[model samples]
Target chain A: GAGVSQSPRYKVAKRGQDVALRCDPISGHVSLFWYQQALGQGPEFLTYFQNEAQLDKSGLPSDRFFAERPEGSVSTLKIQRTQQEDSAVYLCASSLSPPHMYMNTEAFFGQGTRLTVV
Target chain B: SQQGEEDPQALSIQEGENATMNCSYKTSINNLQWYRQNSGRGLVHLILIRSNEREKHSGRLRVTLDTSKKSSSLLITASRAADTASYFCATDVEAYKYIFGTGTRLKVLA
Candidate 1:
């Protein structure tokens, strides 16, 4: 794909079940970020990976949330023991630069995965 | 954690009218960007204004950053029904990490 791609546009998980969301960033992009957005609220930063290195994971809400980008291409966000509060839209964005290093640093985003915990 | 706080949580205006939204942040930012999100969709980058820069314009969108007040505002001129969406400000505090504001929902009636 030419742009960021995310799979499972819609996912409904039973409470306590585990769910994994996938993201494929733009090819050759140096930065990838994950965010969680609740109903009527803005996105909250979750984790960030500069290529294959996970530099920041401070925004992960809990130990149950795990994200990885092993080869620095594809990324995955996994939630263990899904709860109602975990139900939200998971967004993935890819930028061409690594932080504040570029003149034009706007990020390209995927349609996002809308997760529902029932 | 969220850094920017947008004002006028919701706004309504007629088509062809101008709409404005504001955002305030707490920390120093390397750059500030605006994004638009329609209902049930991901965010779309609108504009990016560097800290050293004061204002920027892209099409009908005009963005201003007042670093002294730690605030930014987005103005949409000649808004259309298609322009109805939620606008959010994302502040780049350090690296690729961006903290987004609560957003302002704009409704353009035709």
Candidate 2:
């Protein structure tokens, strides 16, 4: 089975520019998650979607960060007015089931989009 | 705020030896998961242990959890050079968000 896939493995953007990163989850996956990883740091939660419903967006750092998964198969994380602080690797993951009672289920990940804001 | 923290930010060991990493969290969690990541790559799920499980083994990997202490440890025995990577622990907080630890960089010399 194909793993999760993301586009634009590397992106270099100027400060104040807008950037959009794409994520294609595995077929039939019901849950998707987004995270941001700074240099030499662990990934920080961004947002979550379940079958087209954005269940949680609390993890989004600010209003400049937005995400959507209208059809529930593919998702896009968009950053408006990107800042140098936004420079980091953006990761996407998917799981066959929800992380509620089946919390231990593994979540497959993509190589991630490394965005560099200058 | 971060929920989990891994100790010994970096470690170096010889192949065929054992490598151990520990993680601690500040809140209650439904489960804990361990992930491995190569440099310039995404994370790979290594194992997951529910709150009720005390220990689990996958091949040469061993994971143990202590809910009372809100801590977990991952142990790899007879490590190979290929085992060198960054190890991170994530917690399923309130069954919604997966909070990851700072991670430990392990280097195995062959």
Candidate 3:
């Protein structure tokens, strides 16, 4: 697609329920990222993937939060045994490549998955 | 933990007025980026200024970075009601990690 796309715009899950949110990055984009945004706060980094390999998952809140870019194009963030604290907007973003040496490689974001744990 | 902190958690301004937001970071960054979000939706990239380059402009958006002070400022000229949104500052640390700040909520009243 032209922009990053995320599935289940809104998800209401009961405590202990497992929920999966999906993301389809822009075609041919090699870098993908997942972030968690709590109410009245900035999006916190959850994980990053370069192609199909997850380069970083240090920011995932806990074991309950798992993310994968199986084919490097589509990605999923799964939260198992969802807790109330897990309620937030899960955002997916993709970029052409690392901006380290590149002049500009801005991230394109998805509308985000709003997950509510009841 | 966040690498940057934004000042003035919220701001209310009249239309046509200029709006300014500031962000301060702790570590060295390859570049600093500004993004805008409306009603908690997806964020749109506004502008980016490299660490070596002090300033950059995009449309009415002007961004200035002070690597020595580890701070950056975003200025929106002649803000409009449509400009109301949450503005966040992110820093690309090392090569991969992009750390975001708390963000500044801007309200431009018409």
Candidate 4:
């Protein structure tokens, strides 16, 4: 794909329901990131991946929020027992280089999946 | 907590006018980037200024960084209705982690 792609542009789930969001980053991109954007707020870092390695999960809000990139290509973010506060846009971004490089590389973003927990 | 803070949460301007937004951060940074978002979906990278660079230009967009002050500003010249969107400034404090500001909502009226 020419850009990062996310599946199910919108999802509405009942409170306590589990939901999964997927992201397919640009081919061979070494770095991928997941962020959550609340209404009227900027994107908040959720997790990061360097290939299949989940290098950072510190941003994940709670134990219910989990992300994985097992094969280093496609990634999934799963939220267990969703709450109303969990309603927000989930964004995915991929960069050509890793953060350690300190390179001014551009990060391509996907048209985020909007999750609405009812 | 977000490291960066953008000023003027929202601005409305007529087309052809210039739009300027400012961002301030708390700590040292490796680089600062500007991004634009439309309809509150994806964000498009606009420009980036490294810690060593003071200014950068991309077509009609001009970005300036003041590492000493820990601040950056973005200037969009001759804006259009299509330019109406949310503008955010992100600071890279460490490898791969980008701390983003709340953002400025720009509305360029035609």
Docking quality (DockQ) for each candidate = 0.80, 0.81, 0.76, 0.78
Model 2 off-target regions past 4 Å? none
Per-residue error at A5 for model 4, in Å? 0.6
Clash pairs, model 2 backbone: none
CAPRI band of model 3? medium
Model 4 spans with C-alpha error above 4 angstroms: none
* Higher-scoring candidate on DockQ, 2 or 3: 2
lDDT of each: 0.93, 0.94, 0.91, 0.93
Which residue pairs of candidate 3 clash?
Answer: none
Per-residue accuracy of model 3 over B73-109 as CA lDDT, tens digit each: 9999999999999999999875767899999999999
lDDT of 4: 0.93
Q: TM-score of each candidate?
A: 0.97, 0.98, 0.97, 0.98
DockQ of model 1, rounded to 2 decimals:
0.80
Which lDDT value does model 4 have at A90? 98
Which residue window of length 10 is worst by lDDT in model 4 chain B?
B1-10
* Steric overlap count per candidate: 1, 0, 0, 0
Error of 2 at A48 (Å): 0.3
Worst 10 residues of 1 chain A by lDDT: A95-104
Q: TM-score, chain B only, every model?
A: 0.97, 0.97, 0.97, 0.97
